[model samples]
Target: MVKWDEDIYNTPAYPVTDAARYLGIPVVTLRSWLKSRPSADNNDQPALEPLIQRPDPNLPQLSFTNLVEAHVLRIIRATHGVKLDKVRKALDYMSQQFDTAHPLVMKRFQTDGVDLFVDQMDRLVNVSRSGQLAMRETLKHLLTRVEWDEEGIATRFFPLIESVPESEKVIFLDPAIRFGKPVIAGTGIPTASIVSLIDAGDEIEDVADEFDCTPAQVRAAIQFEAQNRAA
Candidate 1:
């Protein structure tokens, strides 16, 4: 059972359970984590703590934008392909919208993190070819600082656009999600490999039969590959 602050109605309210669901934190564990924070007095010097240490009983009452930001942060910490630039912009945007006590810094990456981010975003979004390359490069310019791990991989940020609703299409422009592989809409199977078998003189019926997919699915793969090549 949980209660929310009605004073912040414009902000969506979540039960402790919903917060746990959206943030992927277990309810009991999240409560314990929140309780572990050092109590902050308004008169204190810094006046605030790092995110993991912030104290707020009604954290579930966050503004809609901040809720998304916090959710995004939690997601990024799990998903490795999201870029810091997008995360920075997203965090700052949410802070402005929700009046967060701490705002994220917009930093650029020194390594291949931005490229990876661009690649991932492009794969999820169906941007036109003329703008695809430019958009990828523009994403890189948005950050001023970045950090990577011992493996040189940028710390992955979460809630991939791929997981979002509109990006569910199986178009040619999206090939980064499944190993530089283009998968069918809503399926993990690759489009290119499927179409390749058909193009190499394999009967559409035979290929479909071998793959355990409908003939319509095989045709879709062929069409998708053809359109992409034409583009």
Candidate 2:
């Protein structure tokens, strides 16, 4: 079996727009975040480094780490009202302290770094205890999506579909399945395949029956793909 982390880290499979759609962030915003832009202050200073390095050298694709980093950023943005500047500062501090390129996506963040980062973030700015807890809670929820390896590293991420309810995870990104594209749980059928069948005028019920999945799963796939296409 292909190791989960290897399946993710080694493949530049996730296009920026697809990842942005899945992550509920704007494509342009996500692209901007991934770019190393010239500093506004002075030309002499170094270009700003991206939060997560591009997975593919030739193209702008996000690895699982980039996806996870963006997911955490979404949480921070929605939950804490944290500016990108503050989040970047916190990431820089943790990256320095942990000696890791992406601390938020690494296993150590869950084990030890969450509290450390949160405390350090409090020092950087006044965040209430409630706010801190909220952030931690959001991280916990995000962590649930990750399937860890024996070494405690993230191997797979069961990304939640936005159109689906919190109680339901109709699809996920798995390195061992469908070349890591989003698919329904238990079967490696790509969500796009289902969407394609429906777009061809096939009945959702027949597709579900053929795939041995629920109607809800079929609809979820179609909804997710349609949303991404629209975006």
Q: Identify the candidate with maximal TM-score.
A: 2
The prediction achieving the highest lDDT against the true structure is 2
* RMSD in angstroms between candidate 2 and the native structure over all alpha carbons: 2.7
Residues 1-231, candidate 2, lDDT per residue (tens digit)? 865445555567788888888877888778877877676669899987876676665777787767878877777776677876677789999999988777777778886788887888898788899888877777776767766667665656766666687666678886667777888888878998898889899999999998999898898898888777777
Clashes of 2: 0
Query: TM-score per candidate, in order?
Result: 0.28, 0.87
Candidate 2 matches the true fold with a TM-score of 0.87
**Distance from true position, residue 1, model 2, in Å?**
13
Deviation (Å) of 92 in candidate 2 = 2.0
Q: How many residue pairs clash in each candidate?
A: 9, 0
Off by over 4 Å in 2: 1-8, 37-44, 56-58
State the C-alpha lDDT per candidate: 0.43, 0.77
